[model samples]
Target chain A: MTVADVLLLALGAIAVGSGALVVTSTHLVRSGFYLVVSLGAIAGLYLVLGAELVAWVQVLVYVGAVVVLLLFAVMLTRAPIGPSADLDRPALPAAVIGAGVGLGLTALFVDAFRWTRFPSPDPGTAERLGEQIFGAWVLPFEVLSILLLSALVGAIVLSRPDIGARKAEDA
Target chain B: MPLWLDLLIRVAAVMAGFLVLPLVIGQAEHKVMAHMQGRVGPMYAGAFHGWAQLIADGVKFVQKEDITPRDADRTVFRLAPIVALFPYLVVILTIPLGPGLVAQSLDIGLFLVLAVLGIGVVAVLMSAWASANKYSLLGGVRGAAQLLAYELPLVLAAASVAMAAGTLSLPGIVEAWRPWWLIWQAPAAFIFFIAGLAEIRRPPFDMPIADSELVFGYMTEYTGLRFAFFLLAEYVGIVVIAALTTVLFLGGWHGPFEEQLGWLWTLLKIFALSFVIIWFRVSYPRLREDQLQRLCWLILVPLALAQLVLTAAVKSLL
Candidate 1:
């Protein structure tokens, strides 16, 4: 195998392995942090696959902002930070489910393709992605903006303390 | 050299250089501060101003029992420092130091640098939370929020420069300068450099890791060499950010009659900028979190966008 193949495989392994840790880690805050790692590693794999802009947005939005907010929410709520919560519950079934999905996805991808084909584009990839995003995919881009606005409003609502004590009093 | 060979050498040099630079610069900063304050700095440690300090630090870190607190989450705790230092290493790769001095001058140099540097946020958050420390966790959350507020203006300010210069390629942008881009985009570029300092969590904007508030924030639980690594990363980070500013706003390697000086001109320019960064750290009092956020979003963002328009209009007129 080429060194590129080895490095890419290693990165993939790190993403999947640590992603499981993100779910299983007993400390709720740390779990959110690991989610950033999983997302970032996925971004890195995107880079290796030559999707530089997507990799950056993954770092920017997912790792940089979403996980930060997750940690913020985790901080506000008093989750058990210690061995007070049990860590090991039912990993055997989780392992089975995880492996089955992986195999199923692999089968689907393998079955769908007769031969692999990819378009070669010059770098300055952010600009290239910009052209595609604003040109052919402009409708989806506009829709994505709406989705982002909704998510932002939802987050602000959930974070609002005024809504909480007032609603409790109303109840 | 072949590309593979070149890559290997550059990687080794960066890794080895990063390992040692902190101790050297730490000593230098100490000595300079001491001179400024009228005192002798470390007169000992290998018969001088602590020349072997980083080596001793490295040895201590290697020997220290890697600790995961009883209450701490194991997986994330182990991974945080690695993630923190990795991107710091990755950023120095895109410097485009000179004709032969860069590893790979990827076209999206500035954005890639910003993205890599931004990912360091995750490492800080993980380290803080995984430690299971109250202070560290608070620090992490504050830092995250602070990052969001500052990052928008930082990018906008950078975009203003990119608009004025009309290229995202670091080397190409540098070559476009007739005088200096700094002279042309003085208003925007100055804002960009100052905002860059805040982006890196330097003093005056270091709300998340404030020593007085969070007691070293995410680093509260760390001790000895592991903490040393964090400190090293901070200093190296200062250099990296400064180098980026040098490349983007300043005329990178360009200078008056610099042909004879060769690589010396670029090094000098970058080092001069680095000294200014150090000067700011020594001079400024830290800003509060809200103040930092307001300055970036409410002020700098508008300022940069306006400058971007002004620049484009001027280009069209001239």
Candidate 2:
């Protein structure tokens, strides 16, 4: 209907298509690359929805760090040159789960909004996002930081064989 | 002028800078490295101290045969060079040359720049995996590790500057920069510079492509024009790092007659920083990977965190 609507639809299609490819692709590395495309399209979707900060953060955190870590693990393990037959698994269960989730989400959103039109919100700049995080969402934000810190310490402990060895031996 | 024309001019300007500046830096590296080694670098290319050497190299690359290995993944291998090169071009677009001199300045320009620049790692990964070469894979993995490690400090240091300035926009940060910040933000600047060098895989941080060991790392399997693009991307990366350092840390466009001649000041700072980067390459041997990781995690990250605390304190006080 509108230019913004067109762009939104286009980006959504790209995101969904590439997301499907990410799961279905036989090549492990290619699947990772497809994930990049899917995440990037989601970033574009964020942009279309006027969440600039979230869009870039998506690119930075998801496409940049997370997927690279995924690819890194894949490369560290067996990354065959081409598609390996072993990557194939039973599709029926996965397809059922995927369809159910997709349909449930679609139904929930459709029921919630139900053809309502609302005024466009102001674009989410870094300042506004920061205020929201530190102001209203501060409690959950701090909890998330604590969770991340615990995970980090856990990782370090696991990685360092000597970290708890002496204490364990004494015990 | 219409909107399209204005956009066209900006795009054109960015493209010109993207094409020309890297060649200039490449030539400078050639001459600088040669002179530092007591040798004349390319005295015959453009007839005046080998000014055309990079141009000559470009021509040669263009004429060479592009090769994809038999074992390589065809699509990904071919796509790698473009992936390697595109982010620098995008990152350069948001960099402010002076007040109102940027191509397109977003409210979150600094964040966008960092985000786009981070994607360069994916290019390395793509190339490495697609090459199907042991050396390439090793190089890519090392590169990814190094980039990931340094990325924390890099973002932290930049975050300090953003906090100090109270703005996420490059131009606004420059406007906020005071002469005194040179001392106050010096530690963050140093950390940022070091982390940035590691990000671009420049020496002495260049373990990924340590020629003595890995044989050019992720780029081992690349040949001809594709290899040339990778080389160009490296030079362009140098330019991006230098420009960002100039903009973020060194008081961009803050020299004499800054209102009129600000772009010139920015360019001067960028070139000066680029020379230092080159000097670094010539001076230091490639770092051992363990030492590199240690320097990042043990040194730069903690220092950057301290700098952030200091910045917040200073900002609150001011």
Candidate 3:
């Protein structure tokens, strides 16, 4: 394998490891935090693929919004930040599942494609992405806006306390 | 230089830039403020100006204690800086300094840069939240609100430019503009630049990390070089956004003298834009958080919408 291939594989492995740790961790807060490593590395993989728009969207949506929201939820709920949570119980099963899935994915990737040397894209990826977004992906683009608007409204709704007083009056 | 060596040189150049530019900005800020107030801010740091201020600060930060709050989520707290500093490297990777001079000119450079730029916001949120201090938490909350509000207009403005330019690659965007898009669509350019400034968290719209209310906000508890790291990241961000602004709207490395001294023109434009950022810092007092929110929603958003319409109308007519 080429050096770049090796590097990508190593980084991908690291990403999967961290992501598994994120989900499998007992502490809800640390799990949210570990999601950053998982997501950022995946974005790095996206960068490697020449899909700059997809890569950035991965960062923008997952790192910037989703992970932050997860952390906020953890913090607000307090997630019982303490030593008493079940930290070790899930590790064994998760490790097994993770290893199996990792091997499976890597095998599939290696087996499926006739890999060739792809010349790296010349710069101005964002501009090209914008063009594609408007031209080919215009439907998804508009739908994404609608989705984001809904998410914003839902997040605002969910985050606020009921107060109970306003609910009764409205009812 | 060999290919590897050339790569090293570019990395070093960007690192040196990341390291030095903030110090220069600090000195310039001091000098400017001193001139305004009829007093010299720093006369003793070095020969011409207090040029060695960031250097001195860096050494001090390193020498100083790295404190972690006793109750903090130490892992995430530590992860925060890495997350914060990582984007700069990714952004600089795509940045074309001179003719054929970018470190790695990936085709998707603009997308990579903007994506990385968008990602940096999270570190601020994470830092503030993980600190567990009330002010830090509040700052993170404000940052989340501020980022979501402005991101759409920022993307829309950029997309409008991309529509006119007909490219997604940064270098392509530059090449597409035989005459700068700024002249054809000054209104779009204006909206994008202003929104980009807000996105970068420069005052007067820097509500997320408001200094007065939150006491340095997200990086409050971070001490020593870690705090220095955060500040360095901020200035680097200012440079990147300004560079993007120049590339997209200013016709990148396409000036009269640029053919001869390409880096010079790029830096001159970038440095000029940076001055405006610093100038805003000097002149205007920070906007109220709610006011910052309202300004984006009511003013800039409407302006961007109008620009999009104007652009579409002109394209159809032409």
Estimate, for each residue in B120-167, the C-alpha lDDT of model 2 and write its tens digit. 999999999999999999999999999888999999999999999999
Docking class of 3: acceptable
Give per-residue CA lDDT, model 3, range B204-308, as digits (tens): 777777878888777878998788778777777788778888887887788887767878888888888888878877789888888878888898888888888
Note the Cα lDDT for every prediction shown.
Answer: 0.74, 0.94, 0.76
Give the candidate number with the greatest lDDT. 2
Q: Would you list the rank order by lDDT, best first?
A: 2, 3, 1
Tell me the interface RMSD of model 3, in angstroms: 2.7
Looking at model 1, the pairs that clash are none
lDDT of 1 by residue, B6-110 (tens): 779988877765665545556666666567668876676677666665566578787877666887877767777777787878888777555445666777777
User: Going through the candidates in order, what fraction of the true interface contacts does each contain?
Assistant: 0.58, 0.78, 0.51
Residue B210, candidate 3: how far off, in angstroms?
2.6
Task: Encode model 3's per-residue lDDT on A1-171: one tens digit a residue.
Answer: 886687689779979899887766777667776788799888878767756667778987788777877776665556444343655565677778978998999899888875866777764255576678899999999999999999988887667657444776899
Report each candidate's C-alpha RMSD, comma-separated, in the order given: 4.5, 1.2, 4.9
* Candidate 2 positional error at B227, Å: 0.7
Better of 1 and 3 by DockQ: 1
Count: clashes, candidate 2: 0
